[model samples]
Target: MSGPGYRRVAVPVDGGDLAVGVWEPAGETKGTALLVHGVTSSHLAFTHLARRLPGLRLIAPDLRGRGGSHAVRGPAGMEAHARDLVAVLDAFGLESVPVVGHSMGAFVAVVLAHRAPDRVTGLVLIDGGLPLAAPAGLSAEDTVAAILGPTAARLSMRFRDVDAYLDFWHEHPAFAGRWTRELEAYFAYDLVPGDGGLRPATSYATTVDDTIDLTTGDALREALASLDTPTLMLTAPRGLLDEEPGLYEESRLATMLAGLPAVRHQRVEGVNHYTLVMSPEGADAVAPAVAGVLAGERSTA
Candidate 1:
């Protein structure tokens, strides 16, 4: 975290250390907030968010089996992740804070709030949170494949060097013309030395375990059914590939959110799933959204 106003902290959990990224303003501050990155993403993903909200202290962690915490032990599931997050809160000696989660991180936020409702004051879900509809009768493996597409495949890829990895993401549809220095740093942080070359630090097995659990596990179902936390869901119009309708199709989201009056949904224009938080245009929408969450206000973007 050589970037301005950022520092790293290691919070010990049951199985291993949770790598946390803390960003503080150079001067006065408003308060603190917890940020949870997407599956396969590291705490660095929130670098842009941290800069935009400099007045607010930001705490983001590399979840078990991802980023610097990739080796953290234990099964991958929502409950397990929630427990790790609770440990992070305890380490900071903070009772509760507003939470902002991106992609799969939003799923973790839901469970975190449900299991330890007192630990989260409000939730800001970026391009995720409400569950995606799993195709009927699909096997768990197939579900992972169908849902994640190229994202899951990248874990198996080996890059000859840093440039090769950057080349890979450089061609990604979601990031076309949206690249930045932060994006460069993000992809570089993803690599760890492998047997023959540099491979991504995120564990493939853990990704499978988490994807299966989030898609079919009972934990998420139980959590959302009883969820009462103040939450706002911001969605990107496009998905991981810059495809239309995103993870939550317009018609589908309306139906899925119908039952949960406690949750609110707002669609952000001109961004894909990856850009909704990582890019400047997306951050313009997302950073201000946090203000409403902390103020306990219900409004649309």
Candidate 2:
């Protein structure tokens, strides 16, 4: 298969390089889009989304430590992620670009809009933005244990071959029945030979620290409530959470998000956390939602 309309560009951030991939539209770009991948995912996750939106120039960055990006040797958090995104925009000589973020990337987008309002024209948040409210009294270790199963396993294995790494993801609950060559290539991109075989480039430590910070974060609601940037939040009905049959749990997330004045939230009919970004279903469903937001922003501009 052909690679993404892809090219690697670097931005200086905290004395390190921010590796980003660009997908130029086939024709005129409706608008330039800057995309941020979810936790532990790379720019590859946006291939389907890029394929779907041929009218927009898309840039997908490998956040700090994932994919081809180098990890910071010092401390980092969501704020750092936002700053790196700003750096990317600056390097490209872009101003007031529309930003599309998935999962953890969405959280970063929220913070970016809140902190750097002038730099953003509009925002599209996919399957995230709500405060990661854990059940009260859940310990950091408990949350880590609960969420780190896949990370731990992914990081633990040292694969001599990429196929071994692909096999692991092929059997994962999230990818069950959703496997495709694109997905496999994405999984392959996450590995590098280490110790004896391949391991994920995203440090297990970063994943753990990020999870704790995300779940414990208290500022998202406050951030969204204060931001004036026109925003759209799209979530999946069965996001990393189990819900009662036939219930639209994502709509509940959307309802909660409705509190933000300039924010409009919606739940796509059939999608989940991972598939919400990687599959054709995800791209088809999300493109129009995002296009609608960009169109609205253009009209008002």
Give all candidates' CA lDDT scores. Answer: 0.89, 0.75
lDDT of 2: 0.75
Residue 112 displacement in candidate 2 (angstroms): 0.4
The number of the candidate with the highest lDDT is 1
lDDT of 1 by residue, 1-301 (tens): 2333889999998789999999988788677889999989999998877777757889999999999998898888888999999999999999999899999999999999999999988999998888886786887768888988899899998999999999999999989999999999999998999878999999989998999888888888998999899889999889989999799899999998899987998999999999999988898889888876765532321
Evaluated against the true structure, the overall lDDT of model 1 is: 0.89
What are the per-residue Cα lDDT tens digits for candidate 2 across 1-301? 3333567787778857877889885556688888988878899899888877767788889988778884655555677788889899988888888889998888888888888889888889887766654556667656765654454556656877888778777767666787787898788888765888777888666766666776676546567668788888787766453232212254555566567787777777677777888898888898887677678778888
TM-score, one value per model: 0.96, 0.89
Error of 2 at 65 (Å): 1.6
| Model 1 regions lying over 4 Å from their true place | 1-4, 297-301
Residue 12 of model 2 has an lDDT of: 79
